[model samples]
Target: MVIQHGGRPEELRAAREECAEELGGEPTAPLADDAELSKFYDLQVEAYECLVANGYSPAPPSTREAFVASYYAGESWFAHQPAVPEGAPIPDTVCPQPMLADIEW
Candidate 1:
């Protein structure tokens, strides 16, 4: 995705390092070692990118809980839903407001 605004490369890098540490890795080590951790890491990175792209600085410890909650909620909902038939037209739903709206950045 295009990063239209917020966060320099160095800042994103630092955030990744911090996330790695919190997940039981060295700051410079890879973020994932298995499929489950890979999924978690991917979501975490996406959350970080979305936060910064929306012009909010990373809030670390506070943001982490919300991100994890949202990710799992979405995942659970998706897991229970039936898959669309191939070639089915996708629905155009209204985009929701920012998930971080309540956060004091």
Candidate 2:
């Protein structure tokens, strides 16, 4: 199925979900541990810093503890939230969404 879809992300995700349903497993992978979460948070902070360096006025980030707590509570947390001014689009070239590759991990 992935090959049929040319390995597109949506296809890959759908495949995963289908497999999970059939195998009675989670449809999505969970974060490995707190270390991984910290790395993700660090990358987000770094991205916000990049935006600032490029003269974007992003709101300050919450403390790491708060971030972790929020994440565990299933609340969305993003550094770019409200940092972008209305009517001024932020380009992906400035700071694309952070993935595993975006962190030192």
Candidate 3:
């Protein structure tokens, strides 16, 4: 909703909570397995390298193990840090999130 609606994080978060409440825990799923993690990490690294090549500044990515641990802890990690100059917009071609194929998202 934030991507389309352009709302504050707090508002978006509250909306998410409201939606979750309405669902009443109707859906649940298991975490990704090791093979899935390996595949995703590989793709993420490639995408991060591409972003860096395009002049997007990002810190070195965490080790796959560390990243998996953090992922399980619900921590968010961005390959590119948002350091856009004042009054500047990110280029449409510069994507922070990787597009994964042949894998369930």
Q: Which ten residues in a row have the lowest lDDT in candidate 2?
A: 83-92
Residue pairs with backbone atoms closer than 3 Å in model 1 (clashes): none
**lDDT (Cα) of model 2:** 0.72
lDDT of each: 0.41, 0.72, 0.63
**lDDT tens digits by residue: candidate 2, 9-78:** 9988878888777779865775646777778888888888888888777667888877777886766466
Q: C-alpha displacement of 43 in model 1, angstroms?
A: 0.5
Residue 99, candidate 2: C-alpha displacement in angstroms: 2.3
Candidate 1 ranges with C-alpha deviation above 4 Å: 1-33, 59-105
Candidate 3 stretches with Cα past 4 Å from truth are 1-27, 82-92, 99-105
Off by over 4 Å in 2: 1-27, 74-76, 84-89
Best by TM-score: 2
Whole-model lDDT, model 1: 0.41
Tens digits of per-residue lDDT for model 3 on 1-105? Answer: 233325888877777777777768448677777767667777777767887788766656778887666766756343553443352443436655653344565
Worst 10 residues of 3 by lDDT: 83-92
Among all windows of 10 consecutive residues in model 1, the one with the lowest summed lDDT is 76-85
